[model samples]
Target chain A: MKVYNISFQIDPDLEFQWLEWMKNNFIPSLMSTKSFTENKFYQIKVNADQSPTYTLQLYCDNIELWQAYQELQANDHLKELQYTWGEKCYYFCTEMQIVN
Target chain B: MKVYNISFQIDPDLEFQWLEWMKNNFIPSLMSTKSFTENKFYQIKVNADQSPTYTLQLYCDNIELWQAYQELQANDHLKELQYTWGEKCYYFCTEMQIVN
Candidate 1:
């Protein structure tokens, strides 16, 4: 399986709203695509700024399905997030192959 | 539980040896402490340089235990890694709180 790990640097004040939106809207929509088999969210601790870092790992069956999700759904979802959150949130994504 | 997420940027050439050492030596040694309940290693995909990025997630029952591990074992383990790998492998760590 493959994992799409996305880390978000979000304003601490908006964390509640972000988490609620993700739980009620974003995650369900993504999972509905059936491209991802499972997902996990973590609030990461970094010794940087006060901004909280969160990681969302989505497990996919293969790269092709992941790419398809990116092309068909991810772009719009990302755009929506940016539009709604403005500069309050920023993110980066990394795809990983499970070796063991 | 708390998750210690460590990401390593290693020269791709040394990946095989790194994986072997981690699987046979590092992980087992760390686990022997009984501090971490579980572990996972993933090879991350990024569009950066030729260097490969790997993330090792270690699950601890609590932050206190994690801190104790860092003080007693992690320091030495990290030192040994840097000593042996030098600039070939560099890593950064983030501790995460699982909310769900």
Candidate 2:
């Protein structure tokens, strides 16, 4: 299985807004595409950036499905997030494989 | 629920050995404590340090059990790991809360 992760760091003041957007819009919109079978939102219990940190996880069957997601949907959605949130919420993406 | 993660970076030459020790020794021993309800191992698909990176996750219901684990088991296991692998394998810890 392939797991796609978006590790985000958000200003403390924007946590509530960013979280609502993630739950109501970001996650739901991505899951609706059927490219991913499961998704979860996690708040990292650290303040390394002096802000709230989180990692949104998306699980899919293979890289092909993930690539399709990036090409067709994720690009625009991510772009919009950047434009809307600006530096208040920034993130980096990662993909992982379940090896054991 | 709470998720405890150990993100490890291992020298490529030590990958196989480290994987074996983690699977056969560390993970099983820790799970025997009944502190966590579930566990998963993920290999991050990035050669960020020219080596393999992995995240080992253990899920529990709350922080109390996790703390108990840290007190009774994790300290010893972690120390053992450091003693055994030294610089060949290094890791950092993170705890997370499932917010949605």
| Top model number, DockQ | 2
Give the range where candidate 2 chain A is weakest over 10 consecutive residues by summed lDDT. Answer: A43-52
TM-score of chain A of 2: 0.90
Q: Candidate 2's residue-wise lDDT over A3-48, tens digit each?
A: 9899999989989998999999888888888999999899998765
Extract clashing residue pairs from model 1.
none
Each prediction's TM-score versus the true structure? 0.90, 0.94
State how far residue B13 of model 1 sits from its true place (Å).
Answer: 2.8
Candidate 2 positional error at B3, Å: 0.4
lDDT of 2 by residue, B1-100 (tens): 9998999999899899899999999888878899999998999987556689999989999678888998878878789889999999989999899996
* Superposition error at B60 for model 2 (Å): 0.5
Off by over 4 Å in 1: A62-64
- Candidate with top TM-score is 2
Residue-level lDDT of model 1, residues A1-100, one tens digit each, is 8888778988889989999988888778778889998998888877766688888889998778888998888888788778888899999877888768
Complex DockQ per candidate:
0.87, 0.95
Per-candidate RMSD, Å = 1.9, 1.6
- Pull out the clashing pairs in model 2: none
